[model samples]
Target: MSVQSESVTDTGPEQTVGYTLHGNRYLNITNRCTLRCAFCPRFNDEWTVQEYPLRLRRDPSFEEIVLAVGNPEEYQEIVFCGLGEPTLRLYTLLEVATRLRPHARRIRINTDGLANFVYGRDVTPDMEGLIDALSISLNAQNAEIYNRHCRPKLPGSYEAMLDFVKVAREFVPDITLTAIDGLSGVNIPACKKIAQELGVKFRRRVLDVVG
Candidate 1:
């Protein structure tokens, strides 16, 4: 995983927890994830998006995240995308997003679309105004394909992820379902059709482009 010309600086006790790339700021909030995708960057021995190691010593406090973010208005979008699933720390992500809401022009979350499964409830309503957009990795078209490609920790995560997207479209104004490129045998068109049926925008990314 790689990105261009990103610089890093110490933000005190939090270590190198936040990063910026492609005109967006990102937070490394947690290492917990539901799906272990065959092509996930976090599994790489030297995984990094902004050329900075994102593995955290421990999850930082709200104030620590604030200190790391500084002025959120500086970036095009404040994104909750780290080495792991951002929604694993859903409340923290929402709290931090709320505090930065005034300064941030847009807030987004790049996720695996399993928050509902993680929490055993629909969290979309809570994110309504707080999150400006969502970039959900709908890696496959169906539950069987999803389970085969992205080995989920929870058995029913594929259905849960699809359900999450279906509900989020009602609450979130901007939703984009994404499928990864460069992975053999993935039917991108099928994924796009799924997103269309789900009434969300669609995008594709090279698996190695982490940031």
Candidate 2:
């Protein structure tokens, strides 16, 4: 369904259980991104994932997030996920997540793994107790392929991204590093090796193409 067609201002809750969608509430922090991955749909205004449209407006305020999650106890997880990197608004996200924590069964943050450069500080340490699960995008095995595919805006961003994952594992026990299949010359074995080094779980997701 289209986000415009749906009630974008809907603050009502949809309760569910056991890893279900539970009508996930996503916040589009900023459309501007540091990475322009070859497979990224940042330029596409009509992107959709699992029926949740990725069309985004300007960055939202803490109050907007509070209102968006009128009642958080309804969803299985209050996720910080959207078309852009959530950590770009590190302070705002932490505020929102902390407020929703009391009501949410779980809190998760899906990121592109470049928070350090974006925020100019080590962002993971601040999220220790605030976030439940941290899912990061590790789309390539080596720096060469990673740079080619991810097109990160910062220098040494590939290495920095890996470092972010390593550091996050120290605080967040449930850290998962994921990659999109068939894009970055990423092999399962290599990804598993990287995850093993970082002491985190690795997953390969099927890339969805919109017609």
Candidate 3:
């Protein structure tokens, strides 16, 4: 079936409510990810949140994403966020962000910070100037605990994530690294310290478990 057809027929109360493309346009770049975090519902559960379903049988192309955004001027921030990492689609993201930059006041990216490792190239440089704010998931302080919690697909991803943040800080004006409050083996204090070291803001968001 076509994407639009699937989107229309799949409509339900939950799908409509949560996934409604608010003025803050959120672009889900890819379904592929390098990490399967323990606390992330996306890891195992069906990709649905609130009334919006996160399920993606296929990844959308750049033209498709631009069309999805429709009028870029309507949104305050065109955010790159999804059930998966936006950096996985670095070229597409850059193209989309570049297209939206002139229209939207801000372009933000919510990422897992393993883009370099996943793509085997420095992804930070690509985001330069295009991204206004960078929100990365730095879920743990130490490597061992980080691996256990985030379950990154690539080796050295924990360090790679941290390094990405440090490099990203050089270009992106607002860089925030976040962690969930209640995850086991997470050292909030240490994570905060790491954020400080990287010269980025630190945030701890509460993880909500849906039935």
Question: Which structure among the candidates has the greatest lDDT?
Answer: 1
lDDT of 1 at 3: 36
Q: Rank the candidates by TM-score, best first.
A: 1, 3, 2
| Consecutive 10-residue window with the lowest summed lDDT within model 3 | 9-18
lDDT of 1 by residue, 1-211 (tens): 3533343434554356677777777777776688887777666665655466777777777877777677888899888876789898899999999999888999999999989888888899999889999999888877787888798989988788889999998888999999886666678999999899888999987766754
TM-score of each: 0.91, 0.84, 0.86
Return whichever of 1 and 3 wins on lDDT.
Answer: 1
Query: What lDDT does each candidate get?
Result: 0.81, 0.71, 0.74
Per-residue lDDT of 54 in model 1: 71
Residue 74 of model 2 has an lDDT of: 64
- Quick one: RMSD of model 2? 4.8
Question: Predictions ranked by lDDT, top down?
Answer: 1, 3, 2
- For model 2, the superposed segments whose C-alpha errors exceed 4 Å read 2-23, 209-211
Candidate 3 per-residue lDDT, tens place, 1-211, comes to 2123322222232222112243466776666787887766686685754445666766777777777677767667777877677788888889988988888888888898888787777778777789999889888888998889888878888888888887887778999988887788888998899899877899986774221
> For residue 87, what is the lDDT in candidate 3?
82
